[model samples]
Target: MRLPTLRRTRTVEPGIVTGTARLDRRTKRLVGRLRPGDIAIIDHVDLDRVAADSLVAVGVAAVLNAKPSVSGRYPNLGPEVLIEAGIPLLDDLGETVFQAVREGANVRIDGNTVLLDGEPVAHGVRQDAETVAKAMADAREGLSVQLEAFAANTMEYLKQERDLLFDGVGVPEVETRIGGRHCLIVVRGYDYKADLDVLRPYIREYKPVLIGVDGGADALVEAGYTPDMIIGDMDSVTDDVLRCGAEVIVHAYPDGRAPGLARVQQLGLSAVTFPAAATSEDLAMLLADEKGASLLVAVGTHATLVEFLDKGRGGMASTFLTRLKVGGKLVDAKGVSRLYRQNISGSSLLLLVLSAVAAMASAVAVSTVGKAYLGVASEWWDNLVFQIGQLLGRLF
Candidate 1:
């Protein structure tokens, strides 16, 4: 049997990066299909950190954005993330690049221009650390406007989902009992893996009910645990995870349209519909709170205002409102990891053990009965060492 060779990205010239182009209008969907050395062509405006991290993780040769990576609406973190990862980013290539370039086409990015077969398909600004920093600074100046917009969106979401937010009117019932239990809601967002790693001790000790939101189910599975329940639009999750015997809940639109429900049904799996004007992350938190979870620990869910805006959705307002509603029971995974750090270091534990052993030895040496037992132990040790020496001598 012959093995296929792996394709590696290479610089064709001094400043030109060459690789296969992987194009997608949706950055999230594109990231799933990306391979190392592929040039990612995405249409994400103000590309967020999570997407950038995914691109970096895939080791893409370069990123070609159809829209401005930093529109200066707010200090979005994605552009900086990509630049810092040493990945070349050609920004604002326009939507025409998508029409001009085909998927898996051999492409080269020479400085700020994207070329196919030595012909230029698109041209844009080449973003570096300095450019990204300047954009981020400019974006920070527009923070107040974004905050006002966020406030308005919050009010709009409150008006639309007041019943669900306040009364838990539409929360779905699930077989996994969350009542009086710690609930860990995982989202495949910022630092999810690190947070999960730190929470291993907590998870083992408390045995929290694991609830994975869409791709978060995959995150949990990747971290070597099965979700108790999976909630989301079902786009990013895998079929294997869906069949992992987890209770699935479809996050639907407020009008009761659950696109995810169709996929679930087709997979021969049953799922409950949760129709609310909220993101899947918000839905998971609300469900946990409604289901009577004693505590809700969130991993990779947006916790800051900048993160909410970075998500580039008006629906993030629902997350803000959701956090307020569940604030009492909710705790961030970072906070838990920090506060729940192992109290003793390895050396400290070893030293304490040695101290205890020394105290026991001193007590044994001082007492007649203990001294007699110690003598017997010493004689047994000597005899064992002599037997080992004799066995080695015979073997040698």
Candidate 2:
């Protein structure tokens, strides 16, 4: 498969573009410190869309990644999004760039080169949409191999998590009333904000039990909805969200080591520790399902092959198992929004227009000016009838 060569439409000249260098090995941590127009330096390999979107939201001028943005593993869309947003992405600068660069230091990117002061430090391939597209196409060729590995992983996961399939074990009891009710599980994945916005009416009407996984809790809070339960390793959730009266569940390793427990303890908050090998998203679904949730609505959860690959999972072993166990009740937020939207047919629209007109007419009828106008219209009709009869009699 031939990958397209990147076009040079928005090429930067071989001149210095200076900005404060914000360096972090962890992309998520660096995002908080990033300021508009600051250059972002990170060590993310196969950069995912979520991180790319966050960086775009922060309005970074450019990105310098120590690892290959694509890595040929699978077509990661992060680099493409950045390039399309007019933020230049320089990839595969080597791990040494992390050590050489300092936070808040003024760095320069001149064409494909990175420099500190006047000295050259690193050079890399600048990526654009064409390059990313071509890389993704090439990556798809390895899907068969990746799928084999994924199947093996899923088999192993099934062996370990047989209870999830058979007896509903490891499901925790929570104070949230989920049994026989609709549940909305929110994740901080692709276009979650928009999905949540689309769900506003459903949320108001159904008032489903809201479960936020990891940073998803913060997403829910940002959208002005308090989570009924928050579940994850607890690393990405903010401090304020932890105290928002939601029942917190710390997902621990299968060996029962809970790292997030300390943070919860520090806040003088109580949390239930649930140990399992599955992803938090899967765990959340299983918990809701076993707890007797009649319906499960998912937001920002991974549903596509590219999205699964972007998450760096060898195969969607846990996701596959979880969805298999809950697919009967699982529905995407977009699906619900579509159903709600489709209900607004032409007849419904006409009814809405008629109702609006009726409301306006009722308001006008209650006003004195409206009454006077009606009286004038009645007099005009009477005079027109009298004139018509006199003309008829004269003609006869």
Candidate 3:
């Protein structure tokens, strides 16, 4: 096979948003110092709440997609937003591109475009809409790929400390060791809140070792559940949650440039740092297996190809590999909520039926025994009939 290219062909900077896009209050306030035509480099972009019309109204020239929606992952909707706004979008290029070339680089993509890095790379490319669409498709698949890279990096770090960490901690298998025991992972995605509501009773009942991957910790606390442990790079989590009484584990690459650790340390909270390549979600499962959580119930997790790529990730080799390592204890709660029906419990129904039967029997017996009691029973019976009639009237 031919060697892969290190430099991307497209003229793009990973996180740069150029033009007159009206930033959200958060964004506007953040780079408030920035003037019109200045580039905005954002970390993650949500498809929902993307103000396409507003960005177009501001008259931005182009947007740099830092968080590329993978081939089939969650809808980034940035491209559609920019395209509809008549702004060109250069995707998947990040700080590396900017670091590679000093001074600002502007793209001119009307008919075709050219670039001047240290030297020229390519020029006069075809403006094939189909090709651009395909790139967007590939971009959507990037989420899963990025997740795998994270897991792989994490595994390498874990391996270095494996002898020090794994063998000493966990016990022999109790309910099957694959997903691990001492920890439980909760992911907040899709309709996870609704699913967790259904699982709240079960969680209160079983109280499996709790591990929240970043934002899941907040979700746990919001639902009246306590997290025993928390894991993730630490982005997207609130400072309040970082101080929450759980033992925090900060996931980082072996390179040691952990952005979240600073906040954790700044709060003076003691945390165990695990350097691994997998996403916090993967690491949570792996840590559970390492700690020996009996069952791993995942709520609102993204398992499909589309989900993986939406994060601008590559193929999900490591995630698949991690699942193979601990798929047994892993249960997707999406189906659990959908498959089970909710209603009054059997005991409640039985008690209600017995009460009705006893009422009827008491009325009949009292009526049969004596006239005075019969008069009382007749009144009770009439009241019951009237109540039932009113209930039926309302229901019908």
Candidate 4:
């Protein structure tokens, strides 16, 4: 058999870039430790927008991906974004690179070749914006196939998760009360910060039960709110968020094999395990709806087709079903700020200012010292006016 193409070598010269190799299979966890000018090694396929954005924020010198940056599966916007940001992307480097290179080892990348101690250890295809753009253009042709596969997956998901959609069978019982109160389920997704900022008033007024999904817990903590419950696979969540005194519920597969539970146990923390086929966000909504929450507000939830695709989700059936179950009581935070009538109106502000002024005046009126000062000021004002008038008459 003919040898498979190793890499599409490029002639464009990339000057030597030296940095420590920080490797992690999970992009989210790896991004936390990435420092500026470090070479980021990741195994993420179809690199999502969020991960790409995080890597850019970390200012990595170059990215060495063990997997294909663009598989022509879809127009994954990540590789393009990285290339456009002038961060060199080297892709399709064999998985052996991870084994051969140790973490924190100083490595040199000349073009797509990774050198360890001046010895070539791995080779890959150098991706620029032109190449990434071409790949994305080609990937668009496969969109129909992707859509078909998505439909098939969604159908399969619907059959498997019917009980979760209708009866809410897998929702776990928690101490956080949701009955007859508003519930805010925050997911760390599209424009989540802005959404939270917009909902500040609602959060303060209603005191909604805060449920954070994985990284969203950290977002809540950062925003000066303590989450009532933290739910998700514990992979992306930080240890500090775990110890934030929120009740942690680890998500697991239906078979009850919880990968995240081990991490929780390692942290010496107690967590409830909820096993289901749906995503953590779906489970959060189900829990709130089943718990008799009067209203449900969502922040950073991926609602659009592009967003679902950006998440590299094969299908959005779970989200669709979850929305159907909770849509009546659910309100998306994207437009909540526009719809929510502020309790503080212009009239209220004017009234408040008037009330403050009247209170101050009343305090001054009741003080004998204030009366004496006012009298003195009044006499001074009259004397100044008379002096000015006499001077003006003399001049005339």
Across residues 302-342, which tens digit of lDDT does each residue of candidate 4 receive? Answer: 77655666678654557867787789999989655556545
Q: In order, what is each prediction's RMSD in angstroms?
A: 4.5, 7.5, 12.4, 7.8
What is the per-residue lDDT of model 3 for residues 214-328, given as tens digits with 9 covering 90 to 100? 7778778877777777788777566787787787888777556677888899999877677655567877777777654677788766565444443334323345556666687
319-373, model 1: which lDDT tens digit per residue? 9899899999998885555565567889999999999999998998999999899
Q: Number of the top candidate by TM-score?
A: 1
Please report the TM-score between candidate 4 and the true structure: 0.82
Ranking by TM-score: 1, 2, 4, 3
Model 3 CA lDDT for position 27:
30
Best by lDDT: 1
What's the ranking of the predictions by lDDT, best on top?
Answer: 1, 2, 4, 3
* Residue pairs with backbone atoms closer than 3 Å in model 1 (clashes): none
Q: How many clashes (backbone atoms < 3 Å, residues ≥3 apart in a chain or on different chains) does model 1 have? A: 0
Q: Candidate 1 at residue 15, lDDT?
A: 67
**Which candidate would rank higher by lDDT, 2 or 4?**
2
lDDT of 2 by residue, 1-396 (tens): 011233222324544467788998888778877777788999999999888988888877789999999888777778888888888889999976777789988888887789898888898888877888898899878877777777788899899889866688777778888889999999988878778888888899999999999899999999999999999998788899999999999999888899999999999999998888888888899899999999999998988766777887653578888888899999977444445543478988999999999998888788999888878998999999999999999999
Computed on alpha carbons, the lDDT of every model, listed in order, comes to 0.91, 0.84, 0.55, 0.83
Estimate TM-scores for all models. Answer: 0.89, 0.83, 0.53, 0.82
Separate clash counts for every candidate: 0, 0, 55, 0
